[model samples]
Target: MKYNLFISLFVISICSVLAEVYFEEKFKDDSWEKNWVYSKHPGKEFGKFVRTAGKFFNNEEEDKGIQTSEDARFYAISRKFKPFSNEGKDLVIQFTVKHEQDIDCGGGYVKVFDCSLKEEDLHGETPYLLMFGPDICGPGRKIVHAIINYNGKNNLIKKEIACKDGVYSHAYTFVIKPDNTYEILIDGEKVEGGDIEADWDLLPPKTIKDPDAKKPEDWDDRATIPDPDDKKPEDWDQPEHIPDPEATKPDDWDDEMDGEWEPPQIDNPDYKGEWSPKQIDNPNYKGEWVHPEIPNPEYKADPALYKKPEICAIGFDLWQVKSGTIFDNILITDDLEYAKEQLKNLKDKQEGEKKAKQALDDAAKEKKSDEKDDDSEEDEDAEEDDVKPVEEPEHDEL
Candidate 1:
């Protein structure tokens, strides 16, 4: 048992030594401004961000994060980190988003840019290597976008990944492995994951329909055909509508006064729909004509599709009609374990925040209940005071 424990400790230490954290920001203090750059791109109304714990939180100081402070504006902000290449390692980008404002139409995702990006000029037009996070618009669209840029074209994931909603903070984690696979997590739970190439149109299909090929001239794809021997019934020709048998013409009815004295029309029970010969299986009918596929000469496999050779900056370039999204606990790393640990910490904070919020809600509810009771008592007292003792029946007789 002792030997096994020693071995386990050694392995843990080795794993810790291998993990590398490229960038991490908790927004613990006001000095974040020194590290982050706000875009000054012209003509766009950019919103400012405020650091606060919001209305309720676990801890006032520790929970403070940058929150969007404007409505119907663009938010462009980014920060630089040491350049890193994930050529043979896993890349994980994790962050916490608090939609305390109950955002209606806005983006809460982060974009990853290469070192070539000018932080001050970051905007919607700027290219990015990856974009991953929740985006909500109206009630229909509440999706987590996992977009990848390849060969200068942005390709969105083919699968739909639903995101968390409501006014609580949730952690979003995107993991890209060296094997070209990905996993998207919400609050430390895997929501969607699959091969990168299969989910994105980063490359031409391996096989494509042979444009030069055509169906044989005699090929009959129809599975059924009208039978030549079957004939329509004689009664099948009845009109759809006929004069009602039960409806009689009024005695006062006059053809000269009224345009017509016909009875109301009723559906004919004997009427059959449009007549046609019975259908039978066609003897010569062939199955569906499947287009043969051939190897696409344009397609070239990329083993490094998941690699970002010069990832050094991350940005938030979004348009929010309604703001108040708090972003915090941003972390980019090559270590999966480290990212998982960070997520665990976020989950803890979320639990604490929920307790705090519940307490506040309970207190407010109690106060309102007390106020209502006091009002009722006051109303009862006023009613008693307003009631004058019925004047004793004029007591002159007494």
Candidate 2:
């Protein structure tokens, strides 16, 4: 009995680690630094004068350690990461940034890509970046404090943050799924805005600062990501239950933020929700726990798939999954074209209505002028009759 209990506990521990989302580099070296690419686009989709720690990675550094902001251009410090196909369910690029910069945009960010940032990999992959900064999300240039991107449209994950100074190692996390629906978390706070199902365009919505508005001075938000899997686990406890340290945060990094992790009860037996992959039911199960037992709600029920609902097979009304969602149509080949056509039709109809109104106005004006002329002629006739033969009378009087 003791041996069985020990085996069960060991298996459960390994399962928890597999389920969570985090950046893990199993194998890294001097070449990894070269993968961090440098980018400088001021007042653009990301912001003005934005830099990352990943960009400064010089291939010359054989030791590949102790990178600082002054070390390279925009202090771009990042390593190329690629998870095996058989890896866990989802992955996220998590990091902490100290808000240290001359301008308000100084803060850190987390960027995750579907593929590795390799020379052979090139530009085919799309990156989803979560940015956190001091820009307030209101009137002034509509600067977004937090943003996530996919294709062309920038999904403004956070807006309206109090722009302030100091080193705030903010945590920026975004979700990864085949469907592409995602959410943002900052310092454990969840950002609630916009739909991930919406098309990808890192560009801010019109609700942000008007495109024509004067731009603000640019600044970069960056951070140093120490390996969490390092020997001692610097900022975390040895166990997975360990929490992050209380660090300085952006002005709006408050209790009300959407993606922030709620405090967990250290001891609760009744709680059954699993946060890691290890908690999934055994694959050997011949029952409903397997994929076959669960009917594909997306497709028309094939008579062959008829089966009972297992513990995992139960579907929730709130969570509806379509057979297939258009994940990447940012260029808007079909649906966007249809929308534009509808818009043009509406505009043409409006123009036609305006022309009809102008014609009616012109007709009314012409009719009023004609009435005035007739009334004047009638008055002249009356005056002529009233005057009688004034001219002949004058001659007779003379």
Winning candidate number (TM-score): 1
Candidate 1 regions exceeding 4 Å error are: 1-10, 367-398
Best by lDDT: 1
Give the poorly placed runs of model 2, Cα more than 4 Å off.
1-12, 20-22, 25-68, 71-78, 83-89, 100-107, 114-155, 158-165, 176-181, 191-194, 198-398
Decoy 2 TM-score against native: 0.30
lDDT of 1 by residue, 110-196 (tens): 999998899888889999999989999999999999999998999999999899998889999999999999998888888889899
Candidate 2 residue-wise lDDT, 1-398, digit = tens: 99999998777566544443223331134343354443332321211122232211112121122223321123222333333331223323333333322223222333333343332222213343333333321234323245544333446543344332222223333433333344444444555433443433333332333334442334222223333333532333234342334434456656676566444434333334433222333333333221123332333312211111110100000000111000000110112122222222333433443454466569999999999999999999999889855464345545
